[model samples]
Structure formats: structure tokens, C-alpha cells
Target: VQLMLVNLASPVGPPFALKTVTPSAFIQNMLQSTEERLNNTTEVNPPRILEWFDMSNTLHQKFSLIHMERPLFQPFPSELVFQNFTPLQTYKLPLILLNNDKVLRHVKLEQQESEDFFVVGPVNSGSKVAPGMSITFTVGFTPKENKDYEGRLICVTERERFEIPVRAIGPRAILDFRDEIFFPICLVKAFTQKTHLLRNIGNSQAKFKLHTQRPFSVKPSFGTLDVGESLQVTVSFHPLTVGDHREDLLLHYHTGEDVFISLCGSCEELDIHLEPECVTLKRTYIGLTNVHTVSLTNSSDTTLQYCWTMWPIQEVEEKNSVLLQEEKEEESKGQRLFECESSSTAAHHYSVQSGALQENGTTINCFYIFVVQKGEIWPNTTAQFSIVFKPEEAKIYQHTVYCDVTGRESNLPLTITGEGLGPELELSYSLMDMNNVFIGDKDQYDVQMSNVGFIEALFRFSVPDTTFGRCFSISPVEGVVPPGASQNVKVTFQSSNLGTFSEDLLLNVNGQPHPHTLTFRGCVIGPTFHFNVFELNFGDVAFGFPATLTCTLFNTSFVPMNFSLRVLGDGSGSQSVSSSSQVSNLSHKNWKGHAARVRPVEFTIIPAAGSVRAMSDVNIKVTLCSNTVKVYRLALVVDVEGGQTLQNLCDPALSSEAVSREGVSFLHSQASIDADSLRITLHLPDKEPHQSNS
Candidate 1:
């Protein structure tokens, strides 16, 4: 049968004319074609073209068949098809098939295996393609070697089979680098260098070009690298400013590929400083040494060398008065120096050194040099040394110590200062007491002010303007005393009142802020009486025996006095003295009362009642008689009849003691007098054995 082919589908321009062909010849052509087929059997319809209708129009036919020209069936000709495909060796390319038929058709697309290449998709796979549908096959082009690779994609259908040839080229001359970024630090005005490796991981040789910015230099800017070979590119950074700097280092290959590397750096200024920045020596006494320590630190990246020197500070003394014109000129000049003695001589008064005693009691002297040589100090480290000051004068002196480091413009200054003490005022006594002085009496004493120091001492005395000022006075209140010499100042006191008086004498030394206080005290007296004896001690008396003694009384008053004597006894004694009136009324009363216990002691005065002239003396004899083997004490009170009472007559001169010479039990007696009467103390020995038995 004869068939007529026509294209009713949308055409680019004019419609194609109809052409007639035999069905047998058409089937033969379709079966022999290389296009993909749906099945292996040759029972298939002739090639035809159909006008696709909008399925939404229900009246239109869903399927139809018609014949078309050669150009209508094949949009891409053999020459136009991509017979060879080259891709990067690192990646693969997918193979695809498109169906331009107006009716549905079954197709199987797959790859053909070869020794040089392998297909990833299944050649026996099948799928149905609708009109205008494109399906991707599992077939892909993968380059196995650097050489050209050949492969084929087979499309199988029921009527015919088709083959697509493919060729791939592996990439050559690929460029790579070990690092994509480089960072370094550079000092100001200095440079840092680094190296980067450029590698060719590809199969062929690679050509590269290196590039960077200004202040960043690279060596071997352009070079070639073989497969599996690497090249080192050195980069140097020289920063002019003190901050961060950045640049791009690029490697451009001849194959139009680029590798980028970042160059980063920072610049900083170097610094070194001393910990304290200044050293101050401790205060020292004249002829004594004081030491202080200072630390030197290096904070920079490099090592340092240091040196030091010391010198006394010079001061100018102004002696002459300046005129108005000269003063104006000096003010204009900022500062003026006057003609005076040079302080350079003061340098001899002090010395600086360093040393300390070890644990073994041995002294290790690390003496400081006046001018030190270069001493090396590493970065981030500290060094310490001592400065000793020994002052020889009594004046405040200062010196300047300069520490110098290599490459430093100026030296570090340390101040050494100390003061010396001159002659000091030393008092023989800081406190004094002018013992009791009678009322309205005048007394004089002296205090020695000595200069214990090496220089002369000048002092000024100040006394309080209170009662002390009126009652006490000093001679030579202000004066100068030579070194090692003493000056005595007389302190005179005139007692104006009767109570106790005390004062503090203030002595101020020249150039001293505080004054020394010396204390003085005394008491004043009024009209009083004196006694030759205040206490009487009776020696040991034999038991049942009597002992006797005499006490003399003196009248220190200006008038005659009448006196009465009485004897009193302590309660512990067997014998007690009777009351004066009672004893006068009944003389034998005391003896009668104690007759059963023991006989009471007896007392008598030469004149029971007597008178004494002014400034005269009286004698009284006391007799003692005891029958018991015990001690007895009697209070002997000699009272002035109708006269002023006398107190505190227990004078040390009148106190006397007597010892028992016969080995008999001894009795002790002591007498003390107050304002009204005399108090006597008696001690009785242990009762005698013979008396107890009797």
C-alpha cells in the first residue's frame, strides 16, 4: 500500500508538501534506523506525524496517524547531534533522550559497554514517552583516563534501535595549593617572610602566575608545575605603619583557573620600661647605709642592653640681693644661678653600693658600679639591683641616678635622698622631785643639758605661765652648748602655798619641733611639833620579871607646855592599864582587879604632871612588872594640857630596840603616835614551858 506523509503539527514556516511511499520500504527504513525502539519485534506501524489537539475539547480525536517529511521526523540531524562530549575529569555528564512524536511511543535508552569506559544505566530498561516528553537515561559520560574516552548511548524501540556516540576528555594541568591563607606579624620598619606551596594535582603540567599587593612581595611570580609536583612561593611582608595590613595572593593558571591566598600581617612598636620607673633610697642616718631595690623589665620582642650612672645633684645658694632690673632679667631668663659654693663636694658624703649577708653569715657584696657597662636582658624578663646610700653630713642631700639602655634616646632617672642628724640635747633627768620644803621656803636645784651628738646644741626653754611660772624660775633659759659638753641650768622654786606643787619644765632644742618636758614636785609645811622619839621597843623580859626603859620627850614649840602621862595596855595582855582618872581615884584598883589572873604592869613618871619650857626636853621612866608568863605592852601618852595636839611623832630617830640577854622568853613592844594618842604594839612569845607546868 502507498502511504502519503504530511506534517499537520505546528511548523516553523510554510507547511511541508505531502510525499508518497510504500509501506514496506518505510517499515524497512524504520527497522534499520539507529533511534531507540520500544520493543525488539519488528511489528510496528509506519512513521507518522499527528496534529496534537487540546484534550480539553472533547469533540476532537485523541489519536491519529499521518506521514511526514524527513525533516519533520528528525529535528536534529546526524551532523548536528553531539557525537563527542568532553567534560572535566573531576565530574560526569548525564545522557538524555527526547521524543518529538505526536503519538505515544515506547523506548529503552541505555549505554553500550566498552573496555575504555563503562555505562552506568541499564540497556534493557524501558519507558513510555508521550508527545513532547523528554526522559533522561541512566547513561552518563565519565572520563576514566586523561586521554580521550569514547562511549555510545543506545535507544531501543519495537521497530528500530538508535545509537548516540559520546567522547570525553579528562582535565589536565589543574592547579592547587596547600594553604588558602597566610598570616604573619611584622615589626615596624622590619619584614617577615613566609613560603607557600603550589601543587599540580592533575595529570599534566600546569603553568601559574603569582600576584600580590604593594609592601607584599612574592618570589618566583610565574612558574610551571608538573603532575604531582609542587612549587614553593615565598612571600615577604614589610609594613611601614603600626596596624593591620592585608593583601591578596593569587595564582593564575594558563588554563584560565585561579587560586587565591590571603596575606595578612600586623605591625607594632617595641617598648621596654622599668617596673617603678624611678627608685627612691630609704632614709639613712649619718655614717649609716640605706639600700633600695629597683627592677628593670623588657617588654619588647628583642633583647636589650642597659647601663647606668649616678651623680650628686647641684644646688645654687643665693647670697647677694638682686636689684629690680636684675630680677626682671632673671625672670625673663626662666632661671638664674647665683655665685655660691658648689654642691659637688657633697658627693663625697654619700656612697651607693649593693650587697647583703647570706644565710651562712658571710657578706656577699654585689657593689654597684658608678658607670655600668652594657648588661644584656632578654625579652619579657626582669632584672633587679640595689642602690645603697650612706650619708656623712647632717643636711638633706639628693643625688640623681641615670639608667641608660642601648638605642634609647634618654636615660631613666632615679632619686637618692637622705638626711643626717646633728647634735641633740640630752637632759640629765627627764623628771625630778624637790622633796618637801616648808611653806614660804625657797629651794634651788640644777639640771644638766648635755650635747650628745656631734654638733653644737642650741636650746630655748619655756615654762607654763600658771602657778609654776610664779613658783619656779630657771637661769640661762636659752643658750648654746658645744658638742660633748654639758651646761647646767639652775631651777629655783619658792614655795608660796602649803599644799603639794608640781610643774613640767619644757626645753625646746633648735631645729626640733617637739619640746622635752622635765617634771618637778615639792610640798610646803606649816607650824608643827617635833619629837625626839616616836616609838619605843622594849627588849625581852623574863617571865614573872619586870623590865624598864626611858623615853625622852622634846618640845619644839616656842611656848612652855604642861604634860600628863598615862599608860594603856592591849586587850591580849593579862595586865591592863587603868584609866587615868580611875587610877588616880583608886591607885590600887588595877592591881586588885588582876590579882587572880596576874599582876598588872606599873608605870611612873618622875613628875606625874609637869611643865617644860620652850625648846626644852623632859624625861619619863616606864617600869613594867608582870606575874604571868606573857608579854605586856602599855601606851605611853604624854599629852600637853590644853595645848595644840601633835600627830605623827613616830620618828625614826626615837625608835629603839632591846634584846633579851638572859635567854628568857622575850616580849616585843613598839609605839606610834597619832594626833590624839600613842599606839603601842606588843608581841608575846610562846608561853614558857616552866610557867605552863607551874
Candidate 2:
């Protein structure tokens, strides 16, 4: 404000004539002004500075009580003091103020009750003309009585009566607030005991997650911190690095927020008084399972006894049996606790590898064993645990298996529904349908699955075997059927060839495992094939001799045929019969078959040239007997002029031309032929005896 005023008064910022105020003088004046501003500044209202004090000790007759003024209410700084003898009694120390030598008001004092301490009152001490005073708080302790004396004066102030903090009462509070003030006492220290990296990790976790990075392997909190009562708590910390050692630690916790007690040093036997004397359950572990063991662990400097209680271990003695291994373990009257005390609270838990650990009547010792019922347990006799995830391991599934995991206690029926792979798939055809079908008829297949489980479930589907052609695929890759929905999955199939083909569809789903499967069966047939046979074996079809063979045909094609009867060989037989020399249409019989006896030709006939005949292609259709075929051909020999013949002919039905009475042996009557003209200019049965001359 003064700087602003100077600028306002001078316009050009500030005048060279106006000098800056002296820091000391300005401060003194400001103090006076602030004092007047406050309704009553406690700093000026008869400041009670500690001017004198005396202790009953001879080492320093100047039994002086030193009191300085500072911030009184807080999370104030705390302090502690150890004496050779336990103070038989405690006294109140006060610093008072006077008006005209008569008591006008008293400054405030700090006690262990508020939880922590601070400096207040006489805040602006020595500023006012007040007679200073100090009460010697005669802590009733002398050299003769031999014992230990302890006094913790957390914070200070004259008798101005105001709020303060709690401290000096114990080590826990110090560690809990170590980041700020140093408490006046030997506080909780920590370190690593065992060795190993994993265990050390436990400490690190317990540090940040449990206590503020302070190592209190054995976390101890007061039970009842009254005028004079002592309690000890032990803790165990597993060190994880393979090494031998010790590292000083500071454990921290608030006596206010999280827990109601403070932790003190275990260097000596200290008295503790925690409020709310007894609690419902001092300690408890509530999670997936029950308590395993309760062992006393003392990581402090002293040896002590502790007791513990286990969780809900009532009734079932068999389930609650505590097995003691390395040390002695026992169960006491349905109640459990810990008894032994040492420097570490980390108990050797045999129960971890054994069973349910029940606590024996105290916080000292404990025993444990595996309980009848285990956690994370399942009763799936069919559930498979191995997986062959790599492709190299895929084709050979010998390493893989089918499995179903059912809750042993749950007993839920499971069915698998799947696609890509079907189960029981490896299992043969579901049930077969025999009524058969028409070429283009629709058929339904009934695939059966018996749910071993009481409840119904979906069974995955797929085809692991049988075989599938491009003609098939399953629908609703996965289908959902409730328990016992032993329903059918109708598969529609079509046939291309005139025969029967079998195939399987796989189903999966009910957690039969990744590759779990089921079976779907189907058989498709070619138009319900009906005929003499699939094909006819005529031995070797020929010409004109009119070889006769009788066979029956079947009505299979589902169509009626008006097949006319004619004979041809690989043409040899027919060609030898005749080739008329006429451009005009030739007359022939509209012959048909009906069990009539057709007479054999007795005349020599021949084609002028370049003409073909075949009993083979002409013999193509089949009917009657079985949905099959049977053709007949006869060899007819004839003498004719030899000129050019068919080239590279391989048809079994076509016999070579012959001369005279000889059968043919020529692949080609060659001077060559069949520049693909069906007519051969000339051919003879075995080169005529006299050659062309004849």
C-alpha cells in the first residue's frame, strides 16, 4: 500500500525525495499495527515466555524448563526424553502472566492427551512487560529407586490454552509423520531379515501398500496407551534377495486415521495404553478363503509373548485340524492365537503347503493343515488341460484330447456346439436312414447325441471324418439346444454321380474343449440309380456275325426309352455288312428288340470307301437288370480290295480287315487312312491271297 501511495502521490512512479522505510522499523510498526488490528493478539496479551525453571537432578542444578513460542495448533513437532528412573508421578508445568503482580491470565500447556504437540502462546513474546514464569513439573523420580524414567514433551508454549497435536506418545506416530517433524523419541526402525529377490519384493509391496515405505517387518501398535500400560506386537517380513544383512527401517502409521494406536520402540519394555480396551476381533483376514495360521513375530529388539485367534474355525474339528511341523502346533478350545515371540513376525507357514491353519487360543503360536475342501477346485473329469496351439502340432492330434470341465460341486450337464470340427465326429455315423431316395428327392438325417449330464446342453457340430465334397456345408455354424434337446439337425444333400456317397457333419459347443466335436450323418445317392449295371463289359464288340447275348435291363433313369435295335462294331462287323452305292435315300428296317430271333446276315457287303460303323458307341445305353449296361458285337469277315485303312485305331470293337478266310491282324490296312473321314476306301480280310492281282 505504501509503495502504491508513493506512486500515486508522485505520478511519475515515485519521487526521488521519498526514501524507502527501514526494514526493522517498518516491521516493528507493522507488528504494533497488527496487534491493534487483532481483537486481542495473544502474542501481546501478556506474553508468557519461560524465564526460569529447575529440575531435582544434581548433574545440572539449573533445572531449567526452556519454553519458546511458535505455532501451537497442528500436526505439531513432537519430542521425547529418557530418564534413568521411571517417573513415579507426573506434574503439570505452567507459565503464567500477571497484571499489577496479580494473576490476570495463564498461558497454555501441552499434554500427551491431545495426540501430538506444538508451540503457541507468547507468540510475540518479550514484546510485552509480563513477568515470565515456569513450573518445574516435578517428575517424581530419584536416583535411589533405580528403574527407567520416560518423558516425552512433544511441543511447547506458555499457558495461553489452545489446541495442539498428538506426538511423543510413541514411535508409530513419528514414522507416520516422519516426512515433517522429528519426534522426540527413539522410533520404529525396520530392515530386511531373510534373503531372496521374490521375498524382498514382498517388503517393497508391504512398504508402499501397507506403511509409507517404512520397513517395520514387525509392525507393532499399542493396545491401550494409558498412564502406564505396555503392549507388544510382532511382525514378519520375508526378504527375497539371496544375501545376508540388516537395513535400518522406519515404520509409519497414524494413531488417528487408520488405526487407533501408535508404535513405539522395542529397545526397552515400554508401557502402552490403547483406548477402547477390547475389540470384537483384533485381527482378521477376509478374502477368498479362511485363516491359515497365526504366529507371533517379533522383529524388534526385545523378546515377548503374543496371542492370536483364527477365523471361523468352529464346529468341524476334522476340517479345523492344525498340523504343527517344524515347531509345536495345537488347537485350543475352538479359539486360536499366537504365543511365541521373536525378532520377526514372519511365521513359518506349514499350512501353506499343508492345509487349513487354525489358531490356538492366543496371539503367540499357531498350527495349520489342508482343509477338506480346497479353494479353486473343479470336478471336471472330462476337462482337458493340454493344448497343441501350434500348426506343426495340429495335424497329429495324438497329443491333443477332448475334455469337458464340470463343476464337481455344480454338476452341470454340458453339450458342445461347434463348426469346422464335429465331435463323436471321430465316432461313426449317427443313426442311418435306409428307406432310400429318388435321384432328386430330399432326405432328412437324424444325428443323435446322448447327454450324459442330467441337464441338457448345446453340442458343437463339425465333420472330422466320413468326408465332404464341395456340395456341402453346415448351417448356423453353432446351434443352441437346451439340456436334453436331443433334436435332429436335418442335412440336405445332393448327388452328382449315380451312386451312394456317405458323409459326416460335426457338432460342438458345450465346452467340449477347443477342438471338441459331435457327429452328423448323411448319405446321398445318384437319382436312386436303377439299371442293369454302371457299365457293360462286351469283351470286344464286332460286326455282322450277329453275336447274341441275352440280358435284362432295369428301369433306373426314371424315364422310359424307345431304343431302336441296330448293330455296329468298332465298325468292323457292320462295315463288312454293306455300304450302298447310292446318293438317294436308302431303305432300312425300323428294327426294335422284343425277344425275336433275328437271322444272321449271309451276304458279303462292303462300303465303297471312307465310312465307319461301331457296335460300341451304338451299344451305349443300359437298362433293365441293375442300373448297368451290357453290349454285344460279332466279327464278320469279308474279302475286299486293300487300299488305305484307318490309322492308329485302338477301339477293341473294331477288328482289322481280313482277306479270304483269315481274321485281320492289321492295325491299319494302310496305305493309311482316317484323315478323319469315317469311310475307308478299301480294306481286306488279311491281304487277299493274290494281292491286288486277285
Best by TM-score: 1
In model 1, what lDDT does residue 500 have? 75
Mind giving the per-residue lDDT tens digits that candidate 2 earns over 1-694?
A: 2322222222122112332332232223223321132222122121222342222442222322323242222111111222222233332222222212122222334544331222234444433233222222211212223232243333232222333221111111111211111112221221223211111111011221122112224333222233222233333333222223233332322233231122222211223211222212212111111232211122334332221123211222224244332223332342332232224232212112333223322111211222221112122111111111111111112111111111111111111111211122222344454444333333445444444333334555555343333334445445555443444555554332223454444455443444444332344332111222222343432222222333232223221111222222333222222122111323332121211223332222222112212111212222111101123222322111211122112232465553121232222122122222212112113221222210
Residue 8 of model 2: what lDDT?
A: 22
Q: Give each model a TM-score.
A: 0.25, 0.24
Q: Quote the positional error of residue 453 for candidate 1 in Å.
A: 1.0
Local distance difference test scores for all models: 0.51, 0.26
313-372 per-residue lDDT for model 1 (tens digits): 121111112343574577459564222111222111111121111221121122232223
Residue 639 miss distance in model 1 (angstroms) = 20
lDDT (C-alpha) at residue 30 in model 2: 28
lDDT for residue 647 in candidate 2, whole number 0-100: 18
